[model samples]
Target: MPHVLIVDDEPRMLELLKLYIQPYGYTCQLVDSAQQALDLCRQHVFDLILLDVMMPDMDGWTCCRLIREHSNIPILMVTARNQREDIIRTREVGANDYISKPIQEGELIGRMEVLLQQQYDGLSYDRESYRCSYLQQKISLTKTEFELLGVFLDSPRRVWTRDQLTTMLWGAEASVDERTIDSHIRHLREKLRVCGFPIEQHLETVRGIGYRWTHQ
Candidate 1:
């Protein structure tokens, strides 16, 4: 069962979201303040977070930034302020998506499903064995290497710039040089090569751009 954290100042809003999501097999946890939401996140792992933008203390934007410092968990910002600038700022502050107030149930559920699927689909890791399933093969990988491969596999064929990979692997606040990305890719490729996967053919580099994972 997927667990979701819903953060809204209004009690009715929290109850409504719970009512809509619980029937769909999602476990919903509600909190009235961003601080409480943050505390819950620290104690438990949630598949997605529905964050309200406006609140009495510690607004959603600040809460999002603080969470992003240590996690890449998907966050969908909900707010009555639907200006273009507000939406852009939400993304800048590390929100995965945004939704305006009075959200449509269908759209909200669809977006949440997409985010959760992207985060969980096509990747299964066995921490005890240090193995990951990818391309129908179970291969061993270092923690860092597995994370990099998981990102590429999650959105196959999508171009990932070095900076984006750095941000996704290490948080935005971490200092990671672009060259370090190349080194990690090199190591990842070596591990894949040992497993008889054609890393060179599938993991292609776009000159002057970044890297992309493609199946031949």
Candidate 2:
């Protein structure tokens, strides 16, 4: 069973989420404040977190940022609005996914499963040999390509802007063109495709923004 941390300021909301999640075999611990949630997170081990955005002491964005500093555990933000800005902010803060308020049980559980599956299945990397494989098949990549993959996998589903990618790949002072990031992504896609993985389906292009690896 997966262990989940459910955080919301509303008592009823926390209970509702717990009810919806527990039936699916996930064990949950509920907290009514972001700070309490953060404190528990530091002291416990959880498979995933269902975090509400409108907490009193600390907003979900700040909580998510703080969590990302030390953990790569899946975080699914629960928010009242589904506005584009909210979605962008969700990614910027490093959440794996988000669900709008008045949450549908099916949608919530499906999203949770996808995030968890993405965390454990389909991909594996060997740090010592610098090798990457999807579904047990090895795919070759150049050093730059390997690092680019690292960035995407580090924060899967987080929208990574070209400026951010450029800075990450080659320091802020380096004169690397933003388009170089695109070229590397293209090459990465080709290699993944050659290995028979559905690279294009999950490694997405955000067009005006950049890229994010997502199960959706």
Candidate 3:
């Protein structure tokens, strides 16, 4: 079971998230403030984070940047703010992903999984703990990402649709949208590129249907 931290000021949101995630057999921790979240981060590591962006103090954007300074934990910023600028602002502050408020549960979980897969590098799960080569350094990925990526790495020629990837990874835990998958692919490819990995040759788009991995 994956451990996830959901930081929101709204009590109802926290309860709703708890209910949504409990059935998935995940350990869910709910915090109501940015300060509490930071404190929790210092205590233990979590698989992923679901953050609310409109807090009263130390808002999500600043918190996102601050957290990234100390850790690379994938963060999904939630907000009611709808402007593209708002999304971009959160992204610029180092959020792994962004979702507007009144969120669709399916979309949120879907995107969250994609973010996890992308951030964690989705490969090298054969070993108890494995490291992937990147820019002459080794970057460690979580078990989930490592396992997910292992599936893709082993079959470089296979194409995977959004539903396929989500179902394969999250099962009933979460269902992701096609666009969410695309975003993860895009983010993962960029990360790989930065680390000097041959990203483009590995991840190829299959047009309207979905994406494929093709080593050339």
Largest lDDT belongs to which candidate? Answer: 2
Please name the candidate that would achieve the greatest TM-score relative to the true structure. Answer: 3
Clashes by residue pair, model 3: 110-176, 122-149, 123-149, 123-150, 156-213
Root mean square deviation (Cα) for candidate 1: 15.5
Query: Any runs in candidate 1 off by more than 4 Å, and if so which?
Result: 121-216
* Every model's TM-score: 0.58, 0.58, 0.59
In terms of lDDT, the poorest run of 10 residues in model 1 is 119-128
Put down candidate 2 lDDT per residue, 1-216, tens digits, no spaces: 678999999999999999999998889999998889888988987878999999886999999999887766789999999999999999999888999989999999999987765553346565557878776677789999988887877676799999999999889998988888989999999998898777877798998999998643
RMSD of each: 15.5, 15.9, 13.5
Residue by residue across 1-216, what tens digits does model 1's lDDT show?
Answer: 677999999999999989888888889989999999888888887778999999997999999999887766778899997899998898899887998978888889998876765443223344445566544477767788988887876576799999999999998998988999999999889877776665787799999999998633
Q: What C-alpha lDDT do the candidate models reach, one value each? A: 0.82, 0.85, 0.72
Cα TM-score of candidate 2: 0.58
For model 1, the local distance difference test gives 0.82
- What lDDT score is found at residue 166 in candidate 3? 73
lDDT of 3 by residue, 36-77 (tens): 999898788787889998898788888888887786677888
**Given candidate 2, what's the lDDT at residue 23?**
90
